[model samples]
Target: MFFVTVDEKVKDAGPDDLIMEIPKLGTKIVCPTYFLVLPYEDFDYQDEDEDYLPERKYSVAIVLNFWKHTVRKMKDNETRYLPLLFHEVGMGCFKVIKEKNELRMAFGFTDDFAGDGLNIDRDSLEDFSKSVQSIDVLTMSACSPRIFQVTRKSDNPDEPVVSFNISIDECIQDVNNSRNKLR
Candidate 1:
């Protein structure tokens, strides 16, 4: 498991200038007042001597930060939602959207990754994408242990193929509550 530590320089900075540093990865992520951290695991593969080797690894947590003014603008536009960020990873990308009342997230994987052991349900994925809630609860649930789990839905439960147990509603709720508190 990896850990996050705050940089000392951030202490002297203003609210809009917080910096988060992950010592293990020697990486620093800048935030514009509001942010959330979500953990995910990715795999690396290598081919040698006509043999394929897959290595499952833990990568740095995904840090999502948003500007306060941007969110305010989103709220003012009742019929539209703002796309905050699109973060690409080893096998796929994560898209974060901010609506007038909630936050939405979508995860997409490459065709190659899908052909591997990952099995995603299209209907569930769509529902997850549409579900909206408070961001504070969402972030808190994501950070909490066991809130998100990998479950196998195939007839052979012993199979390594699995899907992520996503509770998008909870995540949104948490985020909303946190944002309100900050305000």
Candidate 2:
């Protein structure tokens, strides 16, 4: 068998690069590194025994689906599809904003995460939110964007609203890929 490494920074694999399997490739996992801390009284959680605890125990997470173009041979011809690739290189947190039918997402780099390399303070976060209105989500044929907003009782206007959304098509494709892997 042959192996190839899709560049670590690449979010989408081109058609030619998608058909082969990458041998000895280590698994890549990406998850939210920081969660906004709201008032403890606003959060809730249950234990394994189904008993409610005094303090909240769960945190938030953001998931993004990355895709790669692949072509497969059929009896008479070939078909192309943008398949979901579970690689960390193309996934991260995004700040989502919605005005009407469209949802805008700006990449949230790790550098700006709280207490991180380029930690963002309160004033900086507000400025960041204002700047995001002009940005647009990159359109992809295989994925559809959806956004859901969350608000906390004590949340102020300057505080960022946390939400989660993903490319439904890519998510479904990922599920199918996982099933195929099992077989």
Candidate 3:
């Protein structure tokens, strides 16, 4: 009677019927994640933190609104702590603090200097742009279908306090569309 001995080389290998070298499949996002990036000018986080970042006094703050499903994945799968994981990306992210109720808050961008109460320059586009671009925390965030709401005081004679809202979605869409300009 001939008997075969157990081979030590393949001890760890089990189920000869199964295919060897089966690689783990990577997951693909069928529904692509998207964000809305809002630019905030003259953003401030903390007084002492000003010198911490060398970029400048002003920076672009990024605000992102994500799909609820995406948020769940980030929380459950990512294992990111709630306190550390930021659902939105921006200095004006009052929602985050409010949701957490931690009493921590950061100043956000406005049409003008918030405390000074001075209206933004008539043609302060450059200052505003630079400020938005300079945002320390959210400067590098990406977005799709970006939208912006700008507030401006009305020039009506009768109304002492009137503000108008403007939508900058077109500008954002243009940027997204022309991401790769051929010319």
Segments in model 2 whose C-alpha atoms lie over 4 Å from true places: 1-29, 32-57, 61-91, 106-108, 114-183
lDDT-sorted candidate list, best first:
1, 2, 3
Every candidate's lDDT? 0.26, 0.25, 0.20
Q: Report, for all candidates in order, the number of backbone clashes.
A: 18, 0, 6
lDDT string for model 2 (6-91, tens) is 22222222121112231222212122221221223443323223221111111111111111111111112221122112122232
Candidate no. 3 TM-score: 0.15
Best by lDDT: 1
Q: Lowest summed-lDDT stretch of 10 residues in model 3?
A: 27-36
* Residues 1-183, model 3: lDDT tens digits: 001111222222121111111012111101101111112243333343333121211111111111111122332112111111111332221111112211222212222233322112223322332243222122112211132221223343233111111122322333233222211
Worst 10 residues of 2 by lDDT: 56-65
Which 10-residue window in model 1 sums to the lowest lDDT?
51-60
Expressed as tens digits, the lDDT of each residue in 51-160 for candidate 1 is 11111000111121122233334432232111221122112223345554554433222322222222123332333233322222122113222212222223543332
TM-score of model number 2: 0.21
The C-alpha TM-scores of every prediction are 0.21, 0.21, 0.15
lDDT of 3 at 86: 16
How displaced is residue 15 in candidate 3, in Å?
62
